[model samples]
Target: MIKVESLTKTYGGFTAVDNVSFVAQPGRVTGFLGPNGAGKSTSMRIMVGLTKADRGTVTVGGHDYLDIPNPGRHVGVLLDASAQHAGRTGREVLALSASTMGLPSSRVDEMLDLVSLTESESKRRVKNYSLGMRQRLGIANALMGDPQVLILDEPANGLDPAGIRWMRGLLKGYAERGGTVLLSSHLLHEVQMIADELVMIGRGQIVAQGTPADLLRESGTFFRAVESTQLVEALAAAGIEASPVADGYRTDAEAIEVGKVAAAHQITLIELKLADGGLEDLFLELTAETQRESYQTGGAA
Candidate 1:
């Protein structure tokens, strides 16, 4: 398991990560989620020892990342796919990583096959490869040692729909076989499809963390009515403030409660259902406030 305890980081006076703590457990896929500048990358970098934490600790298995000998055999990490050498071929890059991790050359070809990279494509220089190809090569490099733990930051950024589906199944299978996976991405729908748990961060602090179902259960109910103005006024009068949507309203009250309110107000209901896209809604709600504050102050977040 990957354990992070009160992780913190700062650049000059700006605190990038603030007392962040969480765990990516074995045999589970944990989705690390947040908006841009929410400190997900900083935390991941600290986890792999690429950046030093001003305070707190992060450990893989039972030891610190820097303390592990030949760490590649225990953990696979892909923070930036474009960070590879431009002069080297895709196969060459994997070959070099395999050599550094003390793996035989055969593992290089095995990973290439696993990622479905053709021999011709693998022979091309990194600079000539497309972004999707680069992502595949980076994934292959990470898996070259067949590490038990995976930490990927936006691995599907450049992937096509088919590639994204392939990656989802691959990681799901990997976790099923008892490997731990921590994935961070902006694609909410894709993450919702595969992630077993979610950790939401905003302004460098965790705002929510739970199973998908748990988080959704905590979200507001979506309601629509023929009398939109009356429904809004009724809900507001009952101490339930609902935000208007394109064709509906969202409130934190339960469906039964909404029904009771509508009945009391004599409002004609068109639709009432538990909201899907709960992750997206929750993320926007949490980060939008901070973003607004940043905009008002004329300072970047």
Candidate 2:
């Protein structure tokens, strides 16, 4: 399991992470979600000891990551797929990682196969590899030691649809076997499909954390009326604010209440349903408030 308690980090006067806390348990895939500049990467860096926390702590299993013996064998990490040396071949990269972890050279071949890198591709220098191939190589390197936990940041960034599907299956299988997984990504739909739990951050602080079902339940209703302008005016008159959406308007009002308002306004209903765009809608709602605050404060996104 991974435990992060009151984790904080800052750069100059800007707080990159703020008193954040979350847990990634074994046998579950935890999705770490946030908008750009929301400290997802900063928190992950602190978790792996790549960055120092101003306060609080992050631990893998029961010990600090740096304190763990043969850390690679205990915690597999792939923060940046592009961080690998361009001078090395895919095979060479895995071999180097294996050597550093005191694993046999045969482990390199296994990883290459596991990540489905062809022999030709593995033999070519990383500089010549496509982003997808590089991502595969990075994943291979992370799993080279068969670690008990995995922390991947935007692992699907460069993947194709098929590659993304494969990665989802791979991570699911890993978690099924009792390995802890915490991955951060902008792919909300993908995260919704695979993550057992979600931790959403905005402006360096956790705004929400729960299972997909729980988050969905927190989402408001979405309704559209035949006469959009009249409906908006009617809802406002009823002391309810509604925002215009692509299809129509969105409000926190339940379907029953919206129906009453539409009926009173002599407006016909076009569409009325819960606005559950799954994780996407929830993520946007959670971050939109912070985004507005950032604009007002002239803070970096």
Candidate 3:
């Protein structure tokens, strides 16, 4: 498990992280989210001892990250995929990490395969790999020791749809196996799909933290039809009140009822799901007052 308490960080006159606190439990994926420069990166850096916190405490597995022997064996981190040495081969990077953690050479090969990097690709220099391939290599390196806890920042940034899907499944399986995953990403929808808990930060402060269902104030079914007008008519005919939200309609009716209504009307639904108010809606609502149109005032937290 990862726990952070009263964490604060500052740069010169600006406060980067303001007494931020959150916990990532084992056997669950915790999604860390924020706008650019909201101190999401800074907090993660502190957790891994990459940056010193001005005040407060952070611990991984009941001990400070720096105090852990062979920390990589217990906690994996991928803060910046592009930070790997350009001169080294993908295989060499994992090999070096494995060596540092006293892992066998076979572990390198296992990770490379797990991330779907072929022998040829692993042999290529890191400078030559595409962003997606670099992400894969970075993941391979992080998992080189089969760490029990993972702290990843934007791990899906460069992945294609299929690659993202692959990663979602991999992380889900890892959590199901009782590992802890603290994932930070701008992909809110994907995070909503996989994360068991969420932490939202704004202006260096935690704006909200909870499961998606807890944060979403609206309880209903959301559905969008190809012919929205006619679907609204059909729903009204069925004595259901619906309100427009995003590109869809939200109704107090359950998903099955909405589906049945659409089916009876032959309305083609483009999307249908329970309205746990979606992550996008929750993010925008909670952080709207705190969001900066540009990061100029927020600094490079």
Judging by lDDT against the true structure, name the best candidate.
2
> What residue runs in model 2 are displaced by over 4 Å at the alpha carbon?
233-240, 260-266, 289-301
Model 3 segments beyond 4 Å from truth? 217-277, 294-301
The sequence of per-residue lDDT tens digits that candidate 3 reaches over residues 70-185 is 88889999999999999999999998998899989999889988999999999999999999999999888878778899999999989999999999999999999999999999
Worst 10 residues of 2 by lDDT: 292-301
TM-score of 2: 0.90
Pick the TM-score winner. Answer: 1
Name the candidate, 1 or 2, with the larger TM-score value. Answer: 1
Candidate 2 residue 169 Cα shift, in angstroms, is: 0.9
Identify the superior model by TM-score, candidate 1 or candidate 3. 1
Over 1-301, each residue of candidate 2 has an lDDT whose tens digit, in order, gives 9999999999999999999999999999999999989999999999999999999999999899999989999899999999999999998899889999999999999999998999999999999989999999989988988999999999998899999999999999999999999999999999999999999999999999999888876676777777978988888999888875546666878878888989987999989887775787678777886664332211233
Model 3 lDDT-worst window of ten = 292-301
Q: Which of candidates 2 and 3 is the stronger one according to TM-score?
A: 2
* TM-score list, all predictions: 0.94, 0.90, 0.81
lDDT of 1 by residue, 12-59 (tens): 999999999998899999999998899999999999999999999999
